[model samples]
Target: MNVLVIGKGGREHALVQKLSESPMVDELYAAPGNAGITEATCVDIVETDIDGLIALVHSKDIGMTIVGPEAPLELGIADRFHEAGLKVFAPTQKAALLEGSKSYAKAFMQRHEIPSAAYATFSDPEAAKDYIQAQGVPIVVKADGLAAGKGVVVAETTEEAIEAVDDMLVNKRFADAGATVVIEEFMEGKEFSLMAFVNGKDVYPMITARDHKRAYNQDKGPNTGGMGGYAPVPDVSAEDLTFSYEHILQKTADGLIAEGRSFTGVLYAGLMMTQEGPKVIEFNTRFGDPETQIILPLMKNDLLQVFEDVLAGKDPELEWEDQASVGVVLAANGYPEAYKKGMPIPQINGNVYTAYAGVAGTDEQLVANGGRVLLVGAKNDTAPEAAKTVYQALKQIDNNTDYFYRTDIGL
Candidate 1:
């Protein structure tokens, strides 16, 4: 099968790499792929640039295309691909609203009787501040739209809460995403991720993973686009996974379908294992980044087969190795904020290394392309064992600065 994967990030790179190894795959291509990916798979056009992608797909006689980013899905790229007679592994624009708008997802969960944290949405700065003060601290303030993973501020104190709301609503720091805020009541517990396959109404869970969302280590820092992740969490427990499927994930899928919206591709459910059981933290329409880097390699079935099953509207039976996976992301210094790009990169080690090509420059000398420049992943039969394998594999990259990765990812 000829597969064209959209996006150029670590996730897309991993997806392309995995598919390229599949016996079922005749050829593989990544759109505007990074330098590392081009070595493994053919490179196409830009992911966000739809016309270029479509033209490349058609010109190359691509059999199927998989979108790896949310921006294109939100822009209705799947609709366009469907119109062009191309098989795309993603949801429609209407179905994508579940991730496009924070408020919409919260409302949808409520309507579907999905368990989640209680909260309020506000547009007025003063009212929001008053509500925060009245509600107390340890709450969450979120930019209703995407803010590149830095939108949600889990304020630890009343002062921080006040500052967060004022900064978003009054100071206009978040601008468009903050225009209409979703101030959710913070639910404290162990947070984990559950990603599954969705072909219309059919859902098939891939693997369980937990991601370190904080930019720095010790789980203390602003939200980032995942610093690292590990699969088959020892702490997630068998009971917890089952409870999540029954009380959380199934409801979410049913709720979305009930709204006359059927989802396809990946369904990433962010859940907090609260005392009341698992409650949804949020929903991402596509696969998680660092999470994907780890999970996809553990899949025992052909990547093309799983996605083809999704496209054919079938609940495909999937299998995985009895192992865990760990992936660590290396980001440019001062990421999720102002930072320089196109700096020479140092080789880092790992079992599989992928570059996002965030910086369009020479690949021979590694360059800082995006906030997260590279991803290194490893797999083992145990989470702790997999984490150590990841660390050992990273020795392959020759970098001086001890790159950023969460020490407590699987702890």
Candidate 2:
């Protein structure tokens, strides 16, 4: 079958690589794909250019469409395709609010009795500042809408919290995404991520992967999408897993369905294990970047089949390798801040898996284009050791660019 994957990130590259391996797939194409995906035929139209994507699909006679990013899904691209009788794995616009609007998601948590953080929303800058001052230090400031996964800011002090709010509201940093803000009391705990295939009724959970969001090695720097990640997070007890499935996952599916919305495709829950229990930190409508690079490598089954089941609204069983996987993202120096691009990118060993993100230019040699350049992945007996091995393997690829990556992903 002819398939079209959307987005231009490591996650999408992983999708492209896996789908290519599936015998069920006849031809594959990616929308606005990056340098890492040059091996896979890529189109140039950006994902947010929905009209262009739709036209391409129709012209190419694409049989199936898989969305890799949340922005297009939130913008109702899936609904558009479904309306045109095209098979798509993503949910309709009405159901996408689970990740589209933070305010709506938080409100849903309250209504469904799902365990989540305490939070307040604001549209006025002064009100946000007032709320921040009243709340004291160590809070999370987030833009109400999508900001390319760079919207949320976790403040460690009261001063930081105030500045974060002002940055979003007063400074117009995030523009429309920051027009309205969500501030929540900071919950101290370890974070774990779970991405599952959901077709409204059926829920197929993938293996858990924890992300290292901090830009620096010691978890002190700013967040830049994700620096690295590992699958099958160690020490996450079975009880917490049950709580996530019973309270967070099950409740979420039932609640969305009850509200006349059927979520199809990926449901990613970013959870922080608090003292009380596992509470949701946030929800993503699709897969995680570095996380996906590792998670896809561990999946033993065909991705096209799973996506097909989602599009057909059928229950599909999911399977994954027992071994653990790890992924580390390589970024140009000064990422999540001002940095240069279009630099020459060197190649990694043929054995290690590499998925590209910020890449432009044509054919032969790939070039660095985005904040995140590529994701390095490998699988082994355990997650921690695999992470270490991946780092060692990545050391061989050299471009001399001011690249940065976190050293302690699974450690």
Candidate 3:
């Protein structure tokens, strides 16, 4: 069957690569794919161009379309595809609200009795400031709407919290996305990413991964989409995994069904393994970027088959390799903030696998086209070993001052 994967990022690159390896997929295509996706034929249609995508699907006789990013999903691309009598793998706009709006997600968690941080929502800047003042410091401030993963601020001081509120509500830093904000009590614990192929009550969880959201080493700097990540995190216990699967993923699937929003795509739970147990920090309705770059390589099942089975309401009986995998992002020097683009990217060689994001191909070389250029991933017997291999490959890229990556990913 011919398949089309939507979006233009490392996550979409991973999906294209994995789906290309599937015998079930006769032809694989990516919409507005970046320079690094070599396995699939890249198309020029933007992900949000719903009419263009539907027309392309018809013209190419594409059998299935898999969404890789949240923007297109939130725009109701899936619904558009369905209306055109095309098969798509993604959630509707209403279901995508779980990730599109922080306030909505928090309310959903509260309504379903799902474990999460205590929170309050506010649209008025003064009211938000007052709430932060009363709650004290070390709280989380989030833009109610999507801000491309930069909406969250884990403030350690009241001043910083108030500033974040001002940035969103007053300065309009995040634009309308921050018009409403959700402030939550800080939950202390190690965080992990758990994504599942969810079809209403039937949820098949993937192996656990830990995403390093901080941009610099030792967890310093501003939060990014993700700096790096590793799968099958050694620190997360089997019991903890079980608890997260049951209390979070399963419960969320059931809750969405009860609320008349049965999810039909990747449901990502950004979880924190607290002293009490696993609690959700946030949710994403699509595959995570760097995490997907690492996790998909360790899966033994065919990517297309897994999607087909999940969509069919049948068990895919997911299988995974015993080896661990790691991926580190190569971001523009001033990433998660303003940075230069169009800088020439050095050639990468050897065993390491790569997923290109913000890059465009040139006749001579690849150039940085966006904030995060690409991710270099490697698989090994342990997370540390995989990270070592990845860093070694990253070091091989000829000296260039245009980019930076975290030194510590899987450690």
Q: For residues 1-411, write the lDDT of model 2, one tens digit per residue.
A: 889999888889899999998998887889988756854678899998988998988988889888999889889998888888888888888888888889999999999999999999998878888888888878899999888878889998878888888888888898888888999989999999988888886777888888888889878888779888888887679999988988898889889999998788788999999999899999888887778888888888888888887667666677878898888888988998998888877667734678888877666877788898888888889877787778787777554656777777766
Query: How would you order the candidates by lDDT, starting with the best?
Result: 3, 2, 1
Highest TM-score, which number? 3
**What TM-score should be assigned to candidate 1?**
0.94
Tens-place lDDT digits, model 1, residues 1-411: 778888878888878878877787777888777766663454646667888888888878889888888889888999899898888898888888888899999999888888889978999988888888888878999988877678888999988888888888888887888898888888979888899888766788877888888888788888888888888666777887887877667777787787888787788998898888888898899988778887888888888888887778776788888888777777777776777776776665545554353545554665676888786677777777777776776655435452455555554
Regions more than 4 Å wrong, model 3:
none
Candidate 2 TM-score versus the reference: 0.96
Q: Write the per-residue lDDT of candidate 3 for residues 169-257, one digit (tens) a residue.
A: 99999898999999999999999999999988999999999999999999898999999899988888899899888989999999999
Candidate 2's clash total is 1
Model 3 per-residue lDDT at 130: 97
Per-candidate TM-scores read 0.94, 0.96, 0.98
Q: Point out the higher-scoring one by lDDT: 2 or 3.
A: 3
Q: On a 0 to 100 scale, what is the lDDT of residue 80 in model 1?
A: 91
lDDT values for all models: 0.79, 0.85, 0.92
Model 2, stretches more than 4 Å misplaced? 397-401
Worst ten-residue run, lDDT, model 3? 391-400
